[model samples]
Target: MQTEHSFTLVVAYVDDLLVTSSDSTVITILKTALNSAFTITDLGALKYFLGIEVSRSDFVQQLSQFLSEPRAPHWSAAVHVLRYLKGTINFGLFYPANSGLSLEAFSDADWGTCIDSTRSLTGYCVFMGNSLISWKTQK
Candidate 1:
């Protein structure tokens, strides 16, 4: 583990290594250290991880699009996902232990985000006692 960037975070039952900062330089340095300590498999960027399509938000409504792709076929996706998990085995989403306890959910729809189908995509998420338990978005 690198003294500079080695860290751990937990999201639900998943474990993730929280790299220091979002800076490319820091991430590079950390990746180097990680490679030295163990076999390294780079999934490139923080695009899709563990079935979740991550989108960074700037405000409550305005969300910046990062990347999104159709869910992989269950059978084949497992191998790829597993390899990704192994590579990022130490990384996870971290919620403060002292954070407030609550359960909430939100739903939204896009008029028509699917160019091929000309159909709208709808998505909703359920938070179990505050942490996201289930979510799905599809056209």
Candidate 2:
């Protein structure tokens, strides 16, 4: 409800309660009311949002360059990427079901940073609102 006096909105997302109000007192009052009804913990101020974790693409891309005559070091680097991915599996990209029609695109290039070919290792991701639609990395 929107009113000149005050308006508060509470959104529940996967065990998280997001509360926002036009008035600060309304926020406190709402929190107190919710806390009394159900046990809740207030985590203050958003800090670091864990985004994608990736080693430099050129380094990872290099490992696959010489496919016919791949050396031991190349194999080691490939294994490293696998290990890193496994370690950060819990923090992988999340695409929620509900999304809007906001198209967001991001692209990055290492600018001829490939160890062997010296070609640009480029990558891009497209998102519709908060949902990731397509992504790619190439040399």
Candidate 3:
């Protein structure tokens, strides 16, 4: 079932429901209504969902991949990511309350970056206000 309130929007998939809102009261009310209709357990704040780790602050939200298994180069890459996170534990995207809502993106490609396949390396990041909401790198 799908439900939308003035402050909250809920989308359900099978037994999973994703609720989003700017106000916690709206979310609580929705969850209560849903509980009355069906048996549900509130997981509280979202920390880990699927294979992604989510962290949030007053100004920004951050997401990172949670590795379950890694071998060779993948292990090394995962270690590097962990090191970066450790070093930047206190760092977060800066988005002031007065920041604009404009979205901006920057992308670039390095031709023939892959020595074996001659594939180009492409990377991009999208920012809403001063917070990076999306980023990707591919070859």
Candidate 4:
């Protein structure tokens, strides 16, 4: 943590730590302190965490739909997904301070797209000005 205007956020899960702050020097100091006390590793930038790839936008939510029960018809789609996933390996979200704080959201559902069921997939995307703030896809 720094002064009231500048603060650092650290998320610790088990032994791993994800640290972020507006100032890079603060992050460096925090990491050095943690390493001296706990012998921590600096993994540089965050890539993969838990089971999530930690990149891209709402594409994973759509991908989850096919995982439930993949059929032969979705094979080509799967291949395309592999390519798309590869391209997004370096993707990350960035929201500038100048971006206004206007909260807007939109959602839609694909009614009965499941080949073997009547269920639908619904998804919503929330945006703050030009930055994407939240998104999810669910069945």
Candidate 5:
């Protein structure tokens, strides 16, 4: 194919993954690589990531999503997440042992961002040294 594209591996849960980026061609290339190396499926495009809203950004070269918005992904969205996993089953999250052990947190919220329930949402992420330790978004 001929197009602009990029790809990123978001997360891996067991045999599943969440892959994303702005390039359709890169996605296609990733899918081809995955199919060659393992059992695979291509759930084109990312509409959801980690239960948050996900869609292409206006720049046409990136993806964006909120941190606290609740969502129920449709079939394709779920499949996209799954395909992401298939493409990156070997990836791992590593916090280097020699890295600092200090703990730090960052948090912010948007009041009444949810139009459906008129409730504010909370979003937070914690880090240990230079590694992300935890994160959450709730309403």
Candidate 6:
């Protein structure tokens, strides 16, 4: 359905329906129309859907999380990650409006650094126009 500010699209699969729109008003209208024809319940704003947590703010839309059962080591690792995130809560990548569209990357590896596995640890970051778009580290 079309609205002045946005267009709404509904994708139906089995008994589930995902309604999407850029404008909240359009979404509201679509929900009302659907309710009139079918017994559908609004689940409110999207948060944790399936296995992912959806978070949005004025400058960012973040999808986070994976399904995992924590073991003892995993629990301690999770706490460490939480502490790191808390310490860098305000840190983020920023791109200026006039930034050039350029791609850059940096990577490094320490051969045989992991004593237990005798495997190297490697990490890298990819940037697009001065904005870091992807990063990863692993053994």
Give the best candidate by lDDT: 4
Candidates by lDDT, descending order: 4, 2, 6, 3, 5, 1
lDDT to native, each model: 0.61, 0.75, 0.73, 0.79, 0.68, 0.74
- Residue 61's lDDT in candidate 1: 23
Determine which window of 10 residues in candidate 5 has minimal summed lDDT.
59-68
Which structure is stronger by TM-score: 2 or 6? 2
Q: Compared with the true structure, what per-residue lDDT tens digits does model 5 show for residues 1-139?
A: 3334443555676776676545655666777788899998656666754433465545212123422453555444656766998999998668898988788989999999799999999999988788886789999
Q: Tell me the lDDT of candidate 4.
A: 0.79
Candidate 4 vs candidate 5: which has greater TM-score?
4
lDDT of 6 by residue, 16-133 (tens): 7778886777788778998999999888876754323566664112112222454666566667778888999999768798876787889999899798999999999987777777
| Model 5 lDDT at residue 39 | 91
Q: Model 4, 1-139: lDDT tens per residue?
A: 6687688888878877788886788898888888788877787777876433466456656665787798876667778888987999889888798998787989999998977777899999988778886799988
The segments of candidate 6 whose C-alpha lies over 4 angstroms from its true place after superposition are 1-4, 60-139
Worst 10 residues of 6 by lDDT: 58-67
Model 2: lDDT to the true structure: 0.75
The clash numbers for all candidates, in the given order, read: 6, 0, 0, 0, 4, 0
Top TM-score hit: 2
Which pairs clash in model 5? 5-23, 6-23, 16-85, 17-85
The estimated TM-scores of all candidates read 0.34, 0.39, 0.37, 0.38, 0.34, 0.37
- Which residue pairs does candidate 6 place in steric collision? none
In model 5, which regions exceed 4 Å deviation? 1-86, 115-117
Candidate 5 local lDDT, residue 21: 48
How many clashes does the backbone of model 6 have? 0
State candidate 1's TM-score: 0.34
**Which regions of candidate 1 fall more than 4 Å away from where they truly are?**
1-85, 128-131
